[model samples]
Target chain A: MTAPDDTLLLIEDLTVSYGAVEAVRGIDLTVRRGEIVTLLGANGAGKSSTLNAIVGLAPRKARRMEFSGSDLQGVPPETVVRRGLTLVPEGRRVFSSLTVDENLMLGGAKHATRGDPAAVKADMLERFPILAERLHQNAGSLSGGEQQMLAIARALMSSPDLLLLDEPSLGLAPQVVDQIFDLIGSLRERGLTILLVEQNVAQSLEIADRGYVLANGRIELQGSAEELRASPEIQDAYLGA
Target chain B: MDIFLQQLLNALSLGGTYALLALGLAVVFSIIGLINFAHGELMTVTGYAICFALIWGLPFPLAVIAGLSVAMVAAFLMERVAFRPVRGASGTTLLLTSFAVSAILRVLFQNLISARPIPVSIPASLSGVLTVGPLHLGMIQLISIIVTLVMLLGLNLFLHRTMAGRAMRAAAEDFAVLRLMGLRANSVVATAFVISGLLAGVAGLLWVAQRGSVDPLMGALPVLKAFIAAIIGGLGSLSGAVAGGFLLGFIEVILQAYLPESLLPYRDAFAILVVIAVLLFRPQGLLARKTLVKL
Candidate 1:
């Protein structure tokens, strides 16, 4: 929950605006190696905005934004990807018309060595058996939870050091949501530093090492999962306790 | 029957040209999601570049290479200056910009040469005929059909099997997600325009060889037909574009054979009607394109 020496992602005073509308107002956050940092909020709480801004998908004027010692300030999305930061965008943005195999093939294009994409694909299928079952089927026809799993597996295909997942559980059955959280929890165990943004605060905290509560484009509360879970403010807003 | 064979050859030749040009258009469309209005001008740019190469005392093959290369440079410049920055600017803005790019390129060529069509002298080597079984195919038509088939096959292989091709397909499916693949969007788009110019240039050459003339406005028909063919084939699929082109070409030539003299004059109109039918019914085109996830 608290790491003193090793920091994987550090963002300080990040401000994002769309035209005159400010989406994120000067938020600071950190995620250490092998940690799952969850940003939780309702719709329009800037959770997605903060996650996106970290990867430069959102245009936020940040005073300091660094990932694994690299300045991700002006890098375009693809460059950000090659730098080992991958975002599984909201709504599982897989190429629907592409076959499951083709989607995975495109996922590995970022690597310097086009390493056996087939092997990576095999690994991905092993992790998500539903995808393996539908290997030849068009990606668009997959069920919502399966689509989300594919999205995560596709991101993993890039072998990213830090994975940003936005709303992976927004539209799925409760069982699927639990499966996704378990998957995220296991990914953290595998040494993947993750920035998970979700509306499901309690579920996210259950998996997250550290958690940040975002409201009105600012970090309303931040602490270890247990601290945040125990906080009276969060309990009142999120847990219904 | 001899004439029917000739017209069948005619239909294939026309189809080849249409497919090549439509491919160029489809490349841009799939990569950037722009129905590039200037793509026609890129074809015109091809024509004018060929005219220039001939004027400069270059050999025909060399002239064609130079023409295609110049067209690619022109296309690249257009993307870097005009298309890329405003790429996400909206369909209307892109449409207007593409038209403007086309108009500007057309005018530049006109002012550089003349305001009229220029005759492209075909080398004596390319002028001949071949007799095969029941059909006698002109060298021009035969060569056009062969080259076009080869190009289409090559494009198909490149798109499905090769890295760059799959990247193009990936870009077509989701340009934003392509960033996750660590491939630059600009490079993918530039590849599209480059291929577009190359094929369009080849089409310009085959067209000139067949017609024995080149004009600044020569690209108008092929461009229009390819776009229509692409729409008919299913707006963004490569094979569909080719299928649509051949279908349109066959339909046009066959109508000429079967229709009354008055209706023969409306061949272009008839071709457009086929496109309209496709749009009205199979809006996803021949292949039925599908998206991956909305939620």
Candidate 2:
């Protein structure tokens, strides 16, 4: 657990809706500096919606929402990214027509305000060797696993302080999933904070510092990773015997 | 052979102008998915500016600059007053809004100026023919082709090498995702419109030079042909739009040059028939790639 002053993101009673259909009801969550917090839920459990609201992609209302000591009320998504928070949206939404290099270039566009994009791009290419090999190829032509790596690498181009990842392993082979989770663990080891939304509950809890389980737009359980992993309710509902 | 060479030059010049116009429309379409029927009015605005500048005895180059500037301003205004308010509306709404803007501008020009064609004076040096080795070439035709080529090269570099240009391309692919990249949507949209206006201005200048006159309705045919070119090229592809423009120009020029006198009267109809045939064969367009829409 982190001290109150060290909290990187603080949200209270956050609600998201699509017209009259409430996707995420009032929920409070917090993440401190250098913590990996996993949000686990089934389809339509509003895990994605919570992440979307945090990044300002969805219409959201909250009693209070702050990131890095700044208010996020009505802040646009782009501004949210500029403020050192970025989202790697579900399904690896790479710009299909653009080249891998070009997609990475766009990811670092916000970094232009504060850092050297060329240096960051070189770092990304080095980190994701597969992306470097296919730098000039169209993003759509990349394999699913490669695309996922590119998506994660693209988000890192911004040098975000807190990363929001939605379903990073939504569709990958077991080995690829292992590789992705390894990458996530490595990212945390490098001192970056992450708020992860995943349906792979067991794998997610294995690496998460803390876990929250949401059902029907509300958080049904919240505890340290060890506590959630040992809970009978979590075992029967999410983990198979 | 000399006559053939002359016709080839004519076709190239006409094709360059059409390509420019089509490319302008394509740029806007790729970004906002708006066909911008009012894009033609931008040409009309430039045409009138050129007329006024020349009538005031300004130099031809100055007149061209004035025309381009006015067209750019008109484009900005159109986006601000008309299109911006309706951003994210359905395709039908945007299309009808652009049509409304077009109609209102045409009527405004008509009521403000004269409905009659106003003659424009080009320097003798520009309109005169240059002779070289058994072939005669119009100076304006050579200039238009060279200018269009240079503009296209510059645009290609901008789109490929620059960050803003990359942002625009990404916006075309997924606008919502682009916003998450921390780019101002308004700036990207404005850049697209500015480039569109610049192309319209230059193409309009070349077109008016060829016709030797300006009128409120002057934009009607060129815009219609450019729109057809955009459709034929694959509505949202930049290079496709250029290819479509050249193809349309080639069909029009070829039919005019070689058709029997009896068939010459149906030249426009024949050109459109060719376009329809092409569309029938490749419905997405000549250069269109499949786009994946995310859930």
Candidate 3:
């Protein structure tokens, strides 16, 4: 059981905007240490924007945004990553021209000061055996499912304390999606806190300890997995009841 | 046979200079998508630095190093002050900003130094000829070719072996994602500028050594040719830039050697016409890999 003060990421009244378009409007959220927290919403429902804002990719305003007891308000994305927060962004934007090994090495570059990069990479490749088998091939040659796996593996190379996964199952086969969720579960079991943003409501609830349903840039509902799974509103809107 | 050998040497030396400048331009462009028209100004910066160093009675090798250092500093300042503000602006805006910078630098050079050409006296040995069997090669030309090859080999090693180099290659493909992977965007862009500046510095030294003079506008015609060569090889492709530079060099040399005297004046025009023909066919240049940027 996690302690009350074991919060890994904490945000309050965080607002993200793009020019005149407000994507996330004054939302409060939290992710405790070593827990899989899911943020579920429809497309353009500010899920990606929330993740982007946290990583400093989107223009943001917030009353409070703290990570691991440190202020994360004005930190740039690069610095944010170095502080042990990693985001696997939407679309799995791997360096398509670079070899898989090269991609993995780049991912581990931030950890040069933190740990043995080669050992971290070796461990990552062990977790994703398919990647080790095709280490020299360009990342673009990988199938969509395989690419998603590579993306996750690449993020793990940083040994981040909190990993933000954005739509990891967006365009994968059903079986592949199951495998990705299983991997997420395994990663959680290894003590990595995850903030997963997904549209796969049924599976996400199954694995998530708690969830927040965001709509029109606001959290519409929040509950434990069992409570959210039984909520009629969640069942109707996301589970396609 | 002697004429052929001399012309071959000329082509290689001239092409080497063009390749250096084009690669410089392509490095920054590949990462940021900015066709920095002020790239030539870096060469001009080196030329002026060399002039000052020589005046300070610095030895020839030291002067060259001074020039390279100045060029690199100039590139850093250019990126920070001029380009950084207009970053993420429209393509036209970026192009205009580069032009504005080029114009400003040229004006500064004219006013601060001299509008007229300044003759730079090189060590007598640099202008000497190297005789091998029945052939004679200008010392400067031989040095240019060797230096160019060495630079290319060094660049190859950097790109393939180092983390920073791989980060640059990755930046060229997907810059945003690279930042997500923990590489600082500013540092990567700065590295590109520094490399380009170094190349421009080398090219400038060779150019001044060959011409025996430095002028504010000397970089204009050569840089235009380099820009054209970069386009011919496909913009943003480093290997293509080098290949395009060599090809452009060969075209000019062949034309200079073979074209009728009456047509000699039109050689550049013919070269441009050839470039157009190539673009009409390949469009992507000689070695541009098809980039399917998945949205």
Instruction: For each of the candidates, give the backbone clash count.
Output: 3, 0, 0
What are the per-residue Cα lDDT tens digits for candidate 3 across A180-204?
A: 9999999999999999999999999
Tens digit of lDDT per residue, candidate 1, span A1-241?
A: 2324688888889999988999899998998989998998879989888877776677878777888888889888888887888899998888887777777777876452134666877888888888989988888988888888888888888888899999999888899899999999889888889999988989988888899989999999999999999999989988999
DockQ versus reference, model 3? 0.46
Candidate 2 achieves a global lDDT of 0.89
User: Which 10 residues in a row give candidate 1 chain B its minimum summed lDDT?
Assistant: B286-295
Reproduced native contacts, each prediction: 0.61, 0.54, 0.53
Model 2: share of real contacts kept? 0.54
For model 3, name the residue pairs that clash.
none
Q: Note the Cα lDDT for every prediction shown.
A: 0.82, 0.89, 0.90
Candidate order (lDDT): 3, 2, 1
- Give per-model TM-scores: 0.90, 0.92, 0.92
What lDDT is reached at residue A143 by model 1? 86
